[model samples]
Target: MRVGSTMLVRQNLTRKLSRSILLVICIGIAFFVFGVLSSFRAGFEGSEANSERLVVASKIGGNETLPLRYFQQLGGMDEIAEVTHVTRLRAHTAGNERNIIGANAVDAQSYASVYADTYDFNAEIMQAFQADRTATLVGRQLAEREGWAVGDRVNLTSFVHMTQDASRDWSFVIAGLLDGAEPTVDTNFLIVRYDYFNAALLRNQDQVNLFGIKPAVGTDINVLAETIDMTFANSTAQTRTQSETAFMSAFLEQFADVALIVKLIVSVSFGTILLIVANTMIFAIRERTLEIGVLKVLGFSGSSIMRIILTETLVLFAAGLALGFALTAAVIPVLGDALSSVVPDLYLTPKVVATSVGLAVVFAVLTGFLPAIKALRLPVATALNHR
Candidate 1:
């Protein structure tokens, strides 16, 4: 298009400044939501999909405890390099109901071996933890939140388990502060010795909620996951084994279908903005029929009319898309802090940016085509009749 025509298009877009700004804000909200949700998915999927470790749980449900013997059976497999088991229970200080948190009863040695790459607690902490039957290691976040310190003797009430004393209360000395290597890695939980937990239980003795396993180097994780499940397929306690991340995803899914919710919100937002921008432009074109007639009379071709209309639409989308993504980038860190318990590394990613840009282009074409075609096909006399 000529410089004169470019100037005309800009004038037409800004003819009603308020409408243009409103449409741009509508589009911006859509893309901002899309960008944020895409980052959330990328954060979870990127970190969890390629992990080599596996989890084995009862077919009934991961929360249901399986025989502790499954731990030994998994460890004996040639494809498995290490194994550990844990059962979790919700706990709070005896007098503090609002402070309720979950604690894991774990085998320290086997757990450290299996999870060395994932967990980053102090080595010295384990010595004190192993030496005391009722010792607990408090995660840094949990300790700070609850005002706990090493050597502090605390009594906790378990919501799920009962002790041989016919009560839910358990006693522990805080052996040390457990910590994670990364700021986003969750260090807001508790860990206790499996032996102490088991010996004190009133029922469901010799059981674990799930087992963690590491595949031997070069062993295919999928093959090992299937083999582990098949071994117990016909047993009294059948197993369902999958990647560690898959298990966590399944657990999170119980609380809410996060992926589905994010997708639904984004889809609705994009669909709403597409229709809004299309209808608004349609009316704007109808109102400008006389001006289009004047332009055609001045020797502007149908192709030029089409180009100018489409260019106007592209400009609006360009502004909106840039503003939306800018907000997404600015808000990602803040959202990550809020959701740190769930998504560890939420942020704008290159893949999400590329995808959003591509989607916006397609949406712009679809939204603009009808109005532009209406202008392109308008005969000079017919458009002039509007005068």
Candidate 2:
């Protein structure tokens, strides 16, 4: 057979078809795990774009309320500008005891302006909502869940807030639906007007659960957060302020360093597979020792033998990675839909694809190098006289 013939490589692979297929399956499983884990880590990391903003909550506890007057103190500071606050309410619709809603009472202008990049809002619809105090912006997912539409009047019963008459009942007009700019964003809640909700409440009327802050154009967020916290350091309503990214990172870290865990898992899997692949290549080339000697006698160079062995390894890697990534692409969207709350936007990213491809090339070289070298160094007389 011609030394450089494609038939030579094909024959070598098919001579042990089941072993080759098994190796490919092993590689495919590794890449699939890597892709899924990488995407999972990305989803848990949350949006990095909103890192510039800050969230200031009461230092007393995670769910403790903050005084509404803190907004004025925070907004008047040089570093802090355009402060927005949220008064959270836990509520469910009348007659439907099953679905609970995480609702917030916010000022329309400040809230929308602060979260402009996070949410997709219509100008006309916001204007209508602003014009009516009873209007609420229901998240698209929540709206769909409750089968609600624009202009639909929703009677809500609050679990926290009570009316002046000691009733938990409140009503709202569905002014519009909320949409997210990011697919991973959880749009399963609603927001009502602060003025209207506070006025109706019998207790804790002038309190806010969270504060959203925009720093001055050139201000450092860490410095800004420090300044804000220090301003109320000696006061009754002390605060814990952090950048949006820091807040999310802290929340995720409460469980574990998930990204690190993913890396460790992938590393172990790839290491095990690497040894398997390299060992298999060595044995396969050893089996072709006598054939290689015949090829040399037929005038084929050692360089040509090297190319054949390396090329076969690459072919195995290419087929395996292709299958693995294709499976990953198919599985991600289904996972995103099923576990939206746990892992949102679970699709493969360009960085991940590039990383996977780069790693594959390096690993393929590592697997093929020793075997290819042995083939290249095998003297024609020695190979021919061998068993």
Tell me, by TM-score, which candidate is best.
1
TM-score of 1: 0.81
The superposed Cα distance between candidate 2 and the true structure at residue 109, in angstroms, equals: 1.1
lDDT of 1 by residue, 40-63 (tens): 876755343336788888889867
Clashes of 1: 0
Q: Each candidate's TM vs. the true structure?
A: 0.81, 0.80
Residue 349 lDDT in model 1? 81
Runs in model 1 deviating more than 4 A are 1-9, 32-51, 126-128, 147-155, 290-311, 321-358, 376-386
Instruction: Output candidate 1 Cα RMSD.
Output: 3.8
Question: What Cα-based lDDT does every candidate model obtain?
Answer: 0.85, 0.85
**Tens-digit lDDT track of model 2 for 314-377:** 8888888998899899999888777665654467887778888988888888999999999999
What's the lDDT for candidate 2?
0.85
Q: Give me the runs in candidate 2 sitting further than 4 Å from their true place.
A: 1-15, 59-61, 90-102, 153-171, 182-186, 201-204, 255-257, 289-311, 369-386
